[model samples]
Structure formats: C-alpha cells, structure tokens
Target: LQKACQSQENNRAGLGADKKEWIRTEDILERLEKVSDDRIYRVKDALRLGVPVNSVKKLTNIDPWYLMQIKELVKLENELMKFNIPEDIPEDFFRTLKVHGYSDAQIAWLMRVEEKDVTRQRKKLDIRRTYKMVDTCAAEFEAKTPYFYSTFDTENESIPSDRKKIVVLGSGPNRIGQGIEFDYCCVHGVKAAKEAGYEAIMINCNPETVSTDFDIADKLYFEPIYWEHIEEILELEKPEGVIVQLGGQTALKLAEKIVNAGYNIIGSSFDAMDLAEDRGRFSDLLKNENIPYPRYGVAEDVDEALRIANEVSYPVLVRPSYVLGGQRMRIVINDEELERHVLSIFKHMPDNRVLIDQFLERAKEAEVDAIFDGEELLIMGIMEHIEPAGIHSGDSSAVLPTYSLSEQAIETMKKYTAQLAKALNIKGLINIQFAIKDDHVYVIEANPRASRTTPFIAKAYQVPFLNIATHVMLGSKKIKDFEFEKKLEGYAIKVPVFSFNKFPNVDKQLGPEMKSTGEAIRFIDDLNDPFFRKLDSERSMYLSR
Candidate 1:
C-alpha cells in the first residue's frame, strides 16, 4: 500500500479519504500506485487526532521527517486558534507563521477572521520580506540575470538601479483564459520598456512561460500573485510605475488593491477597469453612449436572478462578474435551469454576483483590438468569428479582416470602439466584442487591457501591437505617430486546438465556457486553397491514429 501510494504521488494522482480503508483491506497495492492530496489531508487529520507519528509512518510509508513536519503544522494551527483578536498576535508570531508558508488566507481560517484583517495585522507588525538573487553561476561571477525570489531571511540581493524602472506583473500561471497570449504581451512590454530606456522588471510564478525566463527582463522575481508577495517586491524595486494591462485578469484583479495601497499604475486606471468589468457600471456607460447591448441584469441572489431571467425572457446567458475565459458562464433556457445553474455557481463563488443577459441567437460575433493613448484611438484589427455567437471567443475560430460584415457595419464598429476607448480614458490596449443581429450591433463585452487576440491581430497586421501599446503607456508615442498596416491582402484563420483526447472521460461539448487549450493560426493567400483539399483527403489518415 505504501509503495502504491508513492507511485500515485509520483503520478500526481489524488486519492480520496475513502481510499484509506481500501489501503488497509485490499492487497491491490499494485493498483494503488499513487497518493492524492486528500490522502495527505487524511494523514494530517490522523496526526491531529493524536495518532502516533511512528504509526502513521508505518501505515503510509511516508518519511518520519515529513510526518514530524505535519505534526508541527498541526500544532501551529492549534496555537493560532487560541488567539482571539489582533491584539493577541505577537510580533514574532506572525513572522514565524509566514516563514512556515502560512498564507494570509490560511492564517485567517485559523484565526477565524477576514483575510484582510490578517494583512492589516502583518502590516502593523512591520514584517517585510527581503528579495534574493537566483545566482545561476553560484555567485562565482557577477551575473546580469534579474531572476530573483523572496525570502523572510535577512540579506537582500536585489540592488536598486539608478535607471528609471517599470515593474510588469506577469500572469501567475498558464491556466485557461489566461495563458501564452498574455505572456506574449508581457515579453513585448519588457522589450519596449528596455527600448524606452527604462529598466524592465518582471514578477511572476509560472515557470512554463517566457515572461519568467531569467533574461527576459532586467529583473525577474518568481513570486506568487498574493498581495503580500507583491508588496514586498514593490518595496524593494521602487519602480517608476507598474504596468497591469498586459498581464490578463490576474494582474488586472490586483489593480484595485495596488492602487488603494498608493502605487502608481502606468496604463489604464483602475476606475476604467472597474467600469469595464462591473456589469452595472458598464451598462450605464453603454446607455450614456447610446451603444446597443443585450438586455441584462445583475443579481446577488437566486430570486433576483430568476426575476431578471423573466425580464430578459427565456434562454438567458449568465456569468459571474470579473472572470476571464468565460469561466462558469452558462446559457439557460428555462427557470429550472437558471435556478440550478445559479445555485451551482454560488456554491463555489458565493460572493460573486450573477450577470444575466438576453441570449441573442444566430448573431454574428466580432472582436476588435485597439490602442488608445488618452486622446486618439487606433483600431489594430477586426476579427469576425466563424462560429456564431454563444461560443466563447477564445474557443471560436476567427477570420481577420472580417469577411462577413459590411463596410458600413465595420465602420460603425470602429466608431463605437473609439468612443468607448475615449470615454474610458484608456492609455493602452483595449479589446471589445460585439454581436450583430437584425443588422444592429450590440456590445457584448469590453476589456480595457490586452486580450488573447492581441497577438493574433498583431501578427495579422504585421505590426507589434503590444510593443506600441507599451510605449504609448509609457508616454513615448501617440496612436497617429506611427504608420500602421490596417489591412492585409490574405485571410488568416485562428483555429483553436483542444486537449480532449488526453481526457477521454471529460465531455467534448463546447459552449459559452472556453474549453480549448491552445490555438493555431493558418494564413492562406487565396480564399480557396488546394491545401485544404489535401487536408480533407488526409483527415481520415490522421484520425485513424
């Protein structure tokens, strides 16, 4: 059983608490070659319940050292539970907890208080973290690489430079909705920062992305996206400003907190981001601009959602506010489905409000990537989705230089795009999605930051959109100062790639929620290609394997 659990741990397969009994009874140790997170939690629980460390080690075949560490963690939790208020928290106590990898949220759970309270207490204690260099050459030679990490220990390795610097927070991880596209933007932003004679600093945790590469920027900090982690880096770097627009929802979500802490935001203001994300605020803006949008309502409860559904009529689209890649978004056709969906959403995200919009069936969906430099707005490229509305834009295939929309409609979209950008006072990249039904265009969504389509649009137009946006954000250039290629002679189709074959048990159906893992772009000189005929002929040959 121990060998089986070890194997499972190696495979990264999680086992449940129910597997404990099976481990005791079944000799199917060969079948149980992995351990799960729940199994480790069970061990912790057993240790907390006064089970001897040696006994746990005997049963699970885990190292005695690991068991002792778990025992210490449990003891710490028990000690933390004894504290009643902020006054009871000793100065060194919080520092010790942080050194043990106790996050503010975890400490909050133990202390029965809000996470913000923990943050406040930590700040009161003045327990700041120090930054350390990665030291790729073992400190043998002075390295120019900016790779760094944070630690509670004393010695600081991040020496402040004399050059003006712009800190770029990278998207923490490569999850769906926030992936390589944002990294692409970050890389370009770093390059632009260097070209503009400012030291570029990148902070991110994901090792899978180019943004985290040691040499990508002047300084790189591999750190979590938590408030405390960012605060520490900011204290050390003391940058001219931080750029949040290129980091996707991860960095965008931090704008409010960072701004509230009085840090300078270089690109779009937090108010602009809030206006774009908050459904109520965005709806008001659209109304003021006379921009058409689907009838929608925001609800904090199931009753409110149901009422909104009735007002919007059946088949309403629902999503949580401030989410990317259409996470947990769904379309419901009836009251029963709506209620069930709302309940499920609230189960995981109780604080989030539901946004209900009248589903526009058979609408032609389109996307526009534009750059706004406070005064002037430049539309980079307009992409029309091949699949009709309802499919998530990230998962839908799109064609550049829209093949479907009329010239007049395209012009109207550009006008609306500029109007929205100016109204928001945007200073960098902004992406907007629209739906056209019955010859009327309705705004579906607007992101006041770089969208996944920025890279694709940039490649299509043969212009570095992110680089230009970065310079614009830094007050180096305006929209009209640079010559841009607005039109391309050929068509480019963005085809989404899926990882469904790797997860056979998961459903392959695509809908409002994004499901594609990656995307590929294919450019053809002519509308009709013999290459497509060859692809059709070879489809069966590829599928058989």
Candidate 2:
C-alpha cells in the first residue's frame, strides 16, 4: 500500500518522506475487508487518499464487468426513487424475458436495473415480461416521476368564452382492446365539443391511437398520466371543466388523483368510485338496494380461501380487490387448479381481501348504460350479452336494446341502475352488468367511469355521450331535459376481435379475465335470419357495422 502511494507521488512534482517508498502495512487488508461494502467504495477512498488506481485493482481484482453492474445498480436505484413501481409485474418477468431469448445485459437494459441488483422485492415482482403484460411496464415508471411545479391549483379551469367546453382524459392502450375505446370517446367528445361550439383539450400518452391524431382535440399533449404530468395539463389548459369517467379506470384513477390534488373534477367523486369497485362494499350496496348478487366471502389466507372455495363447490371466481379488468382473475373448478392459480396471487395480495364467490353458470347476462348529473338518473339503453355471463362482456357478443327481457326484468333493471346511480351521486356515464337466473336479477359489476361498451352505446344511439358527460362535470342536471341526437337505427351487435393466432399459447377462454385485441360493431334489424358473427382464420372479425 505504501509503495503504491510512493509510485503515484513520484509521477507528480518533488515530494518528501510523506511520499517515500513504503511496504504493505499491518491490518490494512483486514481493516478494508471489515468495513468496505464493495471494491468501488474502497477504490474511491484509495484514490481520494492518493493511492494509485492500478494498485487498488491489483489488490482487489474486482472484475470490470462486476464494476459495471454496481454502477448500473446505483443508476437504477436513483431512477426508481423518482417513480413508483406497479402492484403487478409479469410473474417471472426477468426470467421469462431471459428464456424468451433475452441476455442478462438485455434484460437489465429493458428493466433499467443492474444485472447485480435484479433481486426480487418479493417473488411476486419477479422478472416476467410476456407480450400480454408488456404494456404495464411504463405505468409504474411513469407514476414515479417527480412532480413539477404548477401541478397543484385549488381553482378549476373556467369555461371558454367563444366556444363550448369539452375536456378529454385518455386511457392509453393497456392489455386487451381498451385503448381503441378511449380513442372512440375522444373522437366523439371532440365532435360533441364542436357541436356545442366549445373547445376540446385532451391529455393522453398513446400517439398510436386515433385520439392522438391531433384533429381530435383543440390542444393535445402527450404526457404521462402521472400526478405531475396530469396536474401540468390541468394547469395549462383550464377548460370549462375536466372529464374523467369516459376513458375507463386508468383515466378515472388519474381523475381521482386530480380531485385529491385539489383540482376541479368533472365526473364522479373518488369515494363514489371506490364504492363501485370494492366487491364487499358493492355487494352490500346491492343487498341494501334489494339487488341480488351471488353469495360470496372475502378470504385472508389459504385456509380461509380453501374453505370458501370448498363451500362455493369447486367452481368459483377469484379476483383482486382493485383491478382494471380482472388482470389476475380466473375461474377454478378443482382444488389443484385452484391451488396453482389462487395461492400465488392471494399470497401476494392482502389476505381476506379477495372476492371468492360461487360461479354462476347458464345465466343470461345483460348490461344497462346510463347518464346522470348527481340529482336524476337517465337510462340510456339496455343490452343483452350474446355469450353467457362467465365470458368477459368485452369479449362477449352484445345486442343493443335487449331481446329476451321480460317487462318485469326490464323495469327492475332500469330501476336498479337508476337507484345505484342516484345513490353513488355520480355525474357521468355509468354501466352496470347483471345476470338473470330463475327470473332474479343480480348486479355483477358497475363502472362509474366508461365501460368497454361506451363507444358502442354512443355510436349506436347517436348520442353525444362525451358532450353529455362533459356537461355533467360542469354542474348540468337532467340528461332527459336536454335534447340528444337520435341515432339508433335497426339493431347493433358488437363482436370481439382477437390476435391469439399471432401470439401462440395464450389462454383464450374468458371469465373475469379480459383477452380481446379489438372489436367490431354490426348494425342490422333483420332478426329473421341471424348471422354467425364471422371470424376470419386470422382471429379478426367483421361485423355488419
């Protein structure tokens, strides 16, 4: 060590005994090993203490590749500190990426982590990045970006003087066909804004969608929906008001955040949204309103989950407390499959928080889309699912202006939808899914924000849903009192499109889980000859519309 220092000093100007040749001294190696966490820390100190770099390397022999790993680790930590991580990452995300032909360096590059620091926070956040789950990667990273100034404003943006007011919130493409639906909302929202002689402003990240095509809104900003980015949009483009409930949960969630951040929101409150999502709360609400739902229980651990699973008689549905669309949901018919799928997800999530319920089969499913302004509820229309209730409505075939409805069932459905809407005090579009078994109506789910079916309803009914929702956000009341463009012609059927053939080995069957690439809506009133919703060999379907 002393000799190493002498060589470094010799290269410099003349020096005294302080730079004299020296030998390795007692306890230096032991002292270093006892305190230094890694070679880089030791090297930094040695260089600061005037010891030669070569001598440090010669003594430690730490691999250059390993040093690079350490640096990457530090960089990744700094990055994560800026943003939050999502509750879900592909199971075995890193390992799966590796198996699917990604090198360690490549995996590290994509994850922005050091090869050395890829340790799982829990096995749940393990390295998995299947094509299906890839889009979720940016959510957490985007969420963590440090907020900017001017994102917080206690005052809401006022309406325009020269034009009508339309505020658009975008839902970026996540898994399934959700992205296109948002585009649908943006297109109609802007059109509605134009019809009402108002300016339209949009916030979205996806440039690939039609919403980002520039002509959709007067002002379009490609910003992350993080609190910081959204708050920035709210501050800069203070429109008459904000729209949240039209773009699905991602947009709605951000809207809730905006409300929490002290900005004026144009739709339902965050508390109302929470009631619509929580299974226990929702079920209780339904019961209180005399709406029937399947018997269910919340499970906290394996023992309780298993017990509930047994009571539900093998076939049961399991879903997380808060999810966009059944991301981890599944139907289990046996103990083995139950244990395989249930254990991992339940173990990671809050115990006794999962909705474990008996699976209802052979139930005719239907949907009701409506509009409200916190005072009165207006039923937009009722539609029946082409497939049974088990298939995700997004993936199921649906007919607008339901066919098999009994007058009693129709009246009951309308009343329940209105009741739920009024009780929630929501001020925008709301969709409710119900299943009729033995002539009893059961409320399955409710979306305070837009459902996948919103675009279909708007296009079919020729209603400016975006404009109406926008007005509701601005304190307008009574959708019935306002005139709506009558566009319902004949009948419409919405058929789902899939890319399963292009991506092999993906599970195709649906339940609470959603898995459709896109959809097509067909219009025809000739109920005489039924068409079989044609699917080309490529999994793309062409509907009449």
The global Cα lDDT (0 to 1) of model 2 is: 0.62
Error of 1 at 498 (Å): 0.3
Question: Which residue runs does candidate 2 get wrong by more than 4 Å?
Answer: 1-167, 190-200, 235-241, 311-313, 346-353, 485-489, 532-545
Per-residue CA lDDT of candidate 2, range 285-334, in tens? 88888877888877766677778888867578877666665667777787
What's the residue-level lDDT of 356 in candidate 1?
Answer: 97
TM-score of each: 0.87, 0.66
Please give the CA lDDT of all the candidate structures: 0.80, 0.62
lDDT of residue 11 for candidate 1: 18
lDDT of 1 by residue, 1-545 (tens): 22123222121111212112233323333222346434675676666666788877777788999889878877877888789875588878878877776666567666667778887788788766777778788879987667887777767778888889899988776767778989999999999999999999998877889988898898898887656678778877788999999988888988998898788999888999999999999999999999999999999999999999999997899998888888999989999999999998887677789999999987889999999998888788899887778888988778887876888779889989999999988999899999988778999999999999999888877898899999999997777778766556788878778888977875666688988888888887864666444533432231100
In Å, residue 534's CA in model 2 sits off its true spot by 8.8
Per-model tally of clashing residue pairs: 7, 18
Candidate 1: C-alpha RMSD after superposition: 6.2
